[model samples]
Target: MSAAAHPREREIAADLRLRAARPPVARLSRKVLLVGTATACVAIAGAVAYAMAARPGAASRPELYAVGGPPPERLAALPADYAAAPKLGPPLPGDLGKPILAAGAPAPTMGAAPSASPEQQRLVQEGEAARTSRLFANEAELRADPSPSNVGGEPVVGQGARAVLDGPVDRRTVSPDRLSAPASPYLLQAGSVIPAALVSGIRSDLPGQVLGQVTQDVFDSVTGRFLLIPQGSKLIGLYDSQIANGQRRVLLAWTRLILPNGKSLVLEKLPAGDAAGYAGLEDQVDRHWGALFGAATLSTILGVGAELGAGYRDSAILRALRLGTSDTFNQVGQQAVGRALSIPPTLTIRPGMPVRVLVAKDLVLEPYSG
Candidate 1:
């Protein structure tokens, strides 16, 4: 300010002051902004973490026996043979429509007198027949080659070791009185006892305690399920639906068992028709129908329309019978069959396939020769 305070000196000092002011403003502003953003980011991150941690039972759901897909490491172990074990049952499906002939038809007026539509009239007459029609569900067994590779086809596993019995089939199970083993021994190991249910009704009909005692060595529990291996001469007899082949009237049926890899094994043949014949629906009940309307005013044939609701169209009358829901079916002749034959449903040899099934309680069979 004293000696060098000339014009040039003053200008230089002024410029120096201005430059210092600019640095502090920019630096300070940046520091404040950066700290604010960092604090906000931390707060947001903490909130997100807390929300995620506070949720309850995020994994809550039915623990399906999933396969081929990996579940959590901590998940409980499934039955070791769960995928390979065969299931002996299957369930059902549906859809619906309304009256084609009547619009305001009251729901309460199903069969009040008789002025019902042709279908309804038929339904009423059949209602009585429904009660009259006798339904018999039974099972029969036959031996088939379990080893497909023996026939020389490359042994490729198409399915898991578990057998599956799904889809509709016409068949019946055998009463215990008839599940006797042959006097001869071949494939059947000695002493396989038949199921007690099998003998319940048959016990009264067979010649002796001999029938139940005949085969005590053929049944083996596979993966916790009772399975019957054919004892050379032992036969499973049943009544079933019709199967058409090329010019041959097949009184029985043999559906393919799909493996995990999709390979198949032809399961044993059950009697002509039965719970056993329908590989998968033994767990199902049957509701039979019959009609009696043939005249100038009506002239309707008896019909058995199984499913009657929306989404239930595809449900089997068999499955519906098992379900026994009002909307599932309308029947007069409903038969409750007893447990007779202990036939193993077809094994699904296919690998990696997961099947969800509902198994109804086993049925109880009493005696009936006619």
Candidate 2:
């Protein structure tokens, strides 16, 4: 017998017959699907191709690359202007090249113009001459003693120039050796003192007299190391008398100090006034007065009290006698007080007393040889 037709086979045949009998819609659908799939694949491939082309190492845009990249083998040569120098305007005017000057401006000078006046110029010339002269003199002195035993013997240009230019040696720059054996006048400081002794006796009433002789050397006030006045210098003064509190006091007014170098200088009074022995006499009198007054007052009080007590109990005659005794004691007390308060005589200054005097002004003295 023939195999019975399978159910699946029958269904397959039916589906094939239905598909064959239908319109071309299924084939069209398949074609549409295939076209869509092909379109999507084409779009994906275009995107990938674009990404690879846009990568970092990819070439720039065609226009920029063509201009910036190396020239092509057939490139044309550049124009002549590329190698030519730039054109410039005409040169500045000759007058414009010079510096402009304002009206009334002084003419240009080769160098700084002389600013010194005639007198100043003369002085400068004189100073220059003096400096040159001193320089030559110093050179000569140096040559004369190329190996001089004493280097100090060389004359200093500055010192000599100062002497010539200023008309006198500058005492400030004077060497100690030169000052020690001074041949020029030297100024002494203020407040310097010379010990002196009275040459003759002088009383408070005396007016003018020679005072004394300097017995000791004196030094300069500025440079206390330098000797200013030597021994045996003369001192002259006036005995100035004044009346104070009805007492005459005398002061030795120094007038002149004759230095041993034969130079005379006005002298001032010593800074320390008269010695203690000459002061305070009036104070002593006042003390005496105070003591006497105190004693007298006490005595008077005691005498009056005693008289009153005696008179109260005594008869008239005895009372009178007691009063008289009291009066006598009171009178004695008054007399003692008056005597104590009396002004004493003025102090008298005698000559031959040692004294010190100061230089009135700056004194220029030469060194004494004796």
Candidate 3:
């Protein structure tokens, strides 16, 4: 209806009309593509949900049945009469409460049956008769009987027979009498030193006597020669002071010194001094106590490690703690006691060590030897 259109404009108008008039196939394809995508997304979501449900996890599934089934009755729950039906009745005619032994059974012996043969039995009986007869016989009658002849045809006195025949069994022969010797200057002179060493370690709480030995030869000052108290003589010392738990000091004085000649000289008085290496010994004991404390600590640590390695349970840990604590406490107590009563430094002489002793008075020589 407008003015006559140009040839170029008519071509352009025809192109626009053709574009507008064409079917909306692209839009339809886009919708179709969107629907396919949505379907695929739904399928993926469903697969994921199924996988989650099938996988084993902490989540609990619903039980098929809600209530539990009835419990089965136990045999113990039956009536007393029913339970007692299987028990056996007494077999004896009278209810004596004793088990009935099978018929034809031999009576049970109190102990093993005698297995001795007739010859052995005869010998045993004869020996028993002889022993009874001898027991009733007087000592004089037993002694009057002649000695039994030996295999060599020589009459030999049996020890038993000789004991009865011998005269009143000399009391001295049975138990030797102790020598009664007075203190003599010839035995041990005063102001004489005897070198000796402890036979064993003596504790402050030790009871009774301590033993020692002479380390070297003891010489007489006036004689200028080795005295009868030679080297290797045994020295028995009686602690002068009482050995109490809290008392650590010790004063050892020789009571008796046995000479090499099998004779012993009893000492009456002995002087106390720091002659032996007792000081050094006391120091060593102190060090030992310290080491013991350290050992206790180390043991406690080891116990803890052992308990952990075994298993880290509440009970195990507690038990280990208790044991360790007890052990530590015991060790501490021992150390405390030891410290309270430290051994005197003057009495700390080791075995084989040289020691000097001063005899306070003259000693007596006794025939007895220890």
Residues 12-90, candidate 1: write the lDDT tens digits. 8888884455554434688889999999999999999998785675777777887678777666455556776678533
Write one digit per residue (lDDT tens) for candidate 3, span 1-370.
3545677788888887844566756445888889999999999999999877865656887998765766457845666686566777655454433423233244456787669899999998896565444223466887688555465675555756775777454555455677655354335556666767777666543455767788776554444443556678888876643433333346666677777777776675364344653421231232244555666565566556544544345596677776676667566556655653453322333455444577776553332233
Cα RMSD of predicted structure 3? 28.4
User: What TM-score do all the candidates reach, one by one?
Assistant: 0.14, 0.30, 0.30
Q: All candidates: CA RMSD in angstroms?
A: 34.8, 41.3, 28.4
Q: Which is the leading candidate under lDDT?
A: 2
Worst 10-residue lDDT window, candidate 1? 335-344
**All candidates in order of TM-score, best leading:** 3, 2, 1
lDDT of 1: 0.33
Task: Report RMSD for candidate 2.
Answer: 41.3
Screening candidate 3 with a backbone cut-off below 3 angstroms (N, C-alpha, C), the clashing residue pairs are 278-348
Is 1 or 3 the stronger prediction by TM-score? 3
Q: Write the per-residue lDDT of candidate 2 for residues 1-370, one digit (tens) a residue.
A: 2345677787778887844566655445788899999999999999999877847876866564355667655554444465565666555345632232222245356687669799999997886565444222355566555553447787765775654674534668655663354333456655455567777665433355645887888765555666777889888776643434555444556777787667787666433123333421121112345666686787778677756667356798887877788788787777766765563433444455666665445667655565
Tell me how far the alpha carbon of residue 3 in candidate 1 is from the true structure, in angstroms, after superposition: 99
Give residue 122's lDDT in candidate 3 (0 to 100).
100
Off by over 4 Å in 3: 1-187, 240-249, 272-283, 287-349, 364-370
